[model samples]
Target chain A: MERTRKPQQERAKKTVEAIIEAGFMFISRQSKETLTTTKVADIAGVSVGTLYEYFGNKEEILDAMYARFSEDVTAMLREVTPEVIRKTPDQGILHILQHLREMLSRDNQRYLHCAALLSQNLPEQHVAPIRQVLATLSLQYLSRNPEYINLPNLPVMNYIMTHGGIAALVHQLSSDDPMVTFDELSQGLATMARHMIEGSRRDAEQANP
Target chain B: MERTRKPQQERAKKTVEAIIEAGFMFISRQSKETLTTTKVADIAGVSVGTLYEYFGNKEEILDAMYARFSEDVTAMLREVTPEVIRKTPDQGILHILQHLREMLSRDNQRYLHCAALLSQNLPEQHVAPIRQVLATLSLQYLSRNPEYINLPNLPVMNYIMTHGGIAALVHQLSSDDPMVTFDELSQGLATMARHMIEGSRRDAEQANP
Candidate 1:
């Protein structure tokens, strides 16, 4: 069974990748209404039967794309060590925001469009993985900073405010004619994050002292 | 024309009010999919023709509801004078958040569900009126505080950050069993807003000094 399954496993992986890439392409160039499975299968150069063997439907394919995006984000975030955060929190945050902006802006802003579409139908279960990854990274950053360690429920707070605020700003910026430049948007988010960190620290200190 | 129109005018006014009220009731109690004009007319004790006389379709009824919500929000914001902001920005923000929470949470979370549905299909032109009102009020609040005056493009910044952030939080909180309580959410938002205000002030002062 093992000998027979290896080649099939490799082929399945390739098909899945192709389907996701095709789905992203369609979502970027076409409206959400146009992203049907048959069209995606045609774009991927795979048979409709093969596409069904992998994904149950269009939403399933979109979910795969979303998961792929989340993995990419998590991999990038892993590089932001505690040391980088300690030396210069502002630059560290700015760097992360820049990376996010680039990821979301790739391929003539296809990722943003796809993300918007996927988000509308995202199940509650799908939100947890991304949120958990983000919360973990934020907690790691805060834990490295002596001033921020003792803040009550720091990870949860970071998750809600940072994720929620930046996600909102990104969605707004993804529009055809965003009011602020990417630079301004990123800076605003960084400032908000810094304030949340510092404010929590101050509050904790005041309460204890 | 005037001699014959008086009674008709009063009857028309009452019918319009009844339709609007029924629309709101349906939106609050039922999902958007269930909110048909036929149902609304039935609830309002009017014919479908009369409902159509007042509203073109379901979207038109939803739009009317949104307008009413906006009017209520504007009236509340109108009372938040610069003096109120000056005395205590944190409390002022908290008060606004509470008002927003109350408005969104009304009628067993009907307003929020209706808002989510309306926002999904909201036209570009429709967004402007509400954004304009929010920007004007934020500008008034900032103008009263000398520290915030020197920030570049203050009105636009306020619009993007305040609207984007608060809208995001509201959407998250609208979900059942939200991770954070209203108190925590409001405090977190107030903290972020204060930081944005103070952070910008510091950046401006440092640049000039």
Candidate 2:
């Protein structure tokens, strides 16, 4: 009985994963008027009864995807090295953006929902979207901690963080042979952020002097 | 025949324009399996034969739309003030980006094809797409002329020009009330480019010393 239950458990895990993956693929394609349970199950290659066993509805499946992504982003943000950023922020920004690119570069269908949210929410300018939470937090950190990076040009930072940061990541990660690699992309963004910091420094000096 | 011909010509122009507009709307919505002549005529409130009067087929309809948009963009680019860029490149970049935003901000279905190209081409990382011709030209200009905003970080410039420039414009223009106004977006991008210029100037000084 225990051995038989193990196969059932493995099958159940596979079913849930397939359902979530299908959720992103559907959202990405935007193929239908309304994404019904039957449609999702068909894409997932599972029966409607099996889908019902796991998820009550389509929204719950999407919510699960969101939850998984949010947790991953939260964990990623938590892993930032203070020493690296404090010592040399140019490299720090580079490291952070590279880290971002890595997480995005997974190229898995799971986070297609996040990319979908990112692409969708950006046009709507939903400033507090989950994906932008990192950029938003970075801005807050800049305001709080002058030692790391003191930037008065929050608007510019805000623009680049969303457009330059996320757009580059998404575009680069989506393609097989990208125009800019993650390393090059990271270095370039670091250059961008680092230079902006220099400009801010000049501004501070000009005001005080 | 002269008075009768005038009204007939005006109506003909109107019909052609409607068909083009409907073509963009259908492409934008992507609701159907195949974009047939019948579907386009339905959207245009005309018969399929009427659409054929303006164009041969769906491809011709899209091509006409592309041609019109390309000409408009060409005209806009030709109106650039050389003196403005030569004198104050920071302001020059701001002015140019503002000009670009104005052209994009029309919110007309007429140029929705270009916006669609901008959005669709970005994901696949089509480096030399028509939408990026402006950014590409900007980089080429930088390489050719050191007098105006010279920077050795071509990689960074290329990355930001496409992602920062085009993606920001498309996103900002698509929305009704964008978070970053044309002024704000242009100002932010100018700040971004200007700071990098300052950083480059420092690099030049250090290298010379």
Candidate 3:
């Protein structure tokens, strides 16, 4: 019984992954309007009956795709964010931005499509964990750095920074002609962050002196 | 017939406003899914026939509300953003943030509801105009201000600033326990901008020195 159930579960998991992959591929090449059960099944090389057993409707398929997109994106960030916790603010932002863009654009069309899909039907739940991971990691960064810890309203500032950074990235991806380099965009943000840190340090010194 | 048509148009305009107001109010208190045309008519004190004349469905009413929200918000920013063009970066951010918060909080719940509605169904057309306005206004500011003109990729910086600002505000509003004061939020962003300007000026001077 154990051997039979394990093989069946593995097959079910593979089928689900194939269907999600097919749906994602379909949206990339065609308008989302043209997607249907039969098309997805055909692309996935599965029968409609098998598709129905897993997904109740098209939206359920979309939900599955969205879930996978967010999970993969954040997991990538989680692995990379902590590595930069010890870097200066500008360098830290630069590293994360570089890593994220490189990884996403590794499959450029897939990344853009998933990003467009999430933006069109974005859920607050998906955003919360990403920001939280960012905030938590940065909080660790701050506690370790003696100088920046002096900046007033550090928690609030961290909130603004993470949220603002996330916002800027999303805007860039969704904008027309989003062909700019992460180098240029990251420079703008990194420059902004570097100055804030310097100014804060100056203010702290002036107050103490 | 001509005389009757004029009053009919005026009366039609008034009825449409009333229905939109009622629909707006309903969404503020209840879930959007719970809204029905009959309920909107009942709340507006009009017959369902009158509501139907202007709106084909709930989504149409939502579109109308979104149009009004973006128009009014951008209009308010247009009036106020220019007033800060000559001011320093921090001061400019402060004034705009102050004015926006004061005006919106004057009708806080309505503002929140409208913002939520728009965020939930935000169209690119609506966002494009606001960013354009922001970029246009800041381009004027940069042209007028000698120091910031040296910044490489001024257009890109403007794009980042405006989109980042808009996104941050939306995130703030939609955030759980969003009772933060504008002063604090503005300070963080203002500091970031101020330093970027100063840094660019320093870099330019050093390059030519």
lDDT tens digits by residue: candidate 2, B84-141: 4353556766767666657755766435434644443233223334445556556555
What TM-score should be assigned to candidate 1? Answer: 0.73
Inter-residue clash pairs, candidate 3:
none
DockQ computed for model 1 against the true two-chain complex using alpha carbons: 0.20
Give candidate 2 misplaced runs (Cα > 4 Å).
A1-14, A22-43, A48-71, A78-88, A105-131, A147-150, B1-16, B23-40, B48-71, B78-87, B105-132, B147-150, B175-177
Looking at candidate 3 chain A, the ten consecutive residues that score lowest on lDDT are: A1-10
Q: Put the candidates in TM-score order, highest first.
A: 3, 1, 2
Best by TM-score: 3
Which is the better candidate, 1 or 2, if ranked by lDDT?
1
lDDT of 1 by residue, B45-87 (tens): 9998877776766777777777777676666666655445665
lDDT of 1 by residue, A80-113 (tens): 5544566556677788777777777766776676
Error of 3 at B155 (Å): 2.8
| lDDT (C-alpha, whole model) for all candidates | 0.67, 0.64, 0.73
Worst 10 residues of 2 chain A by lDDT: A119-128
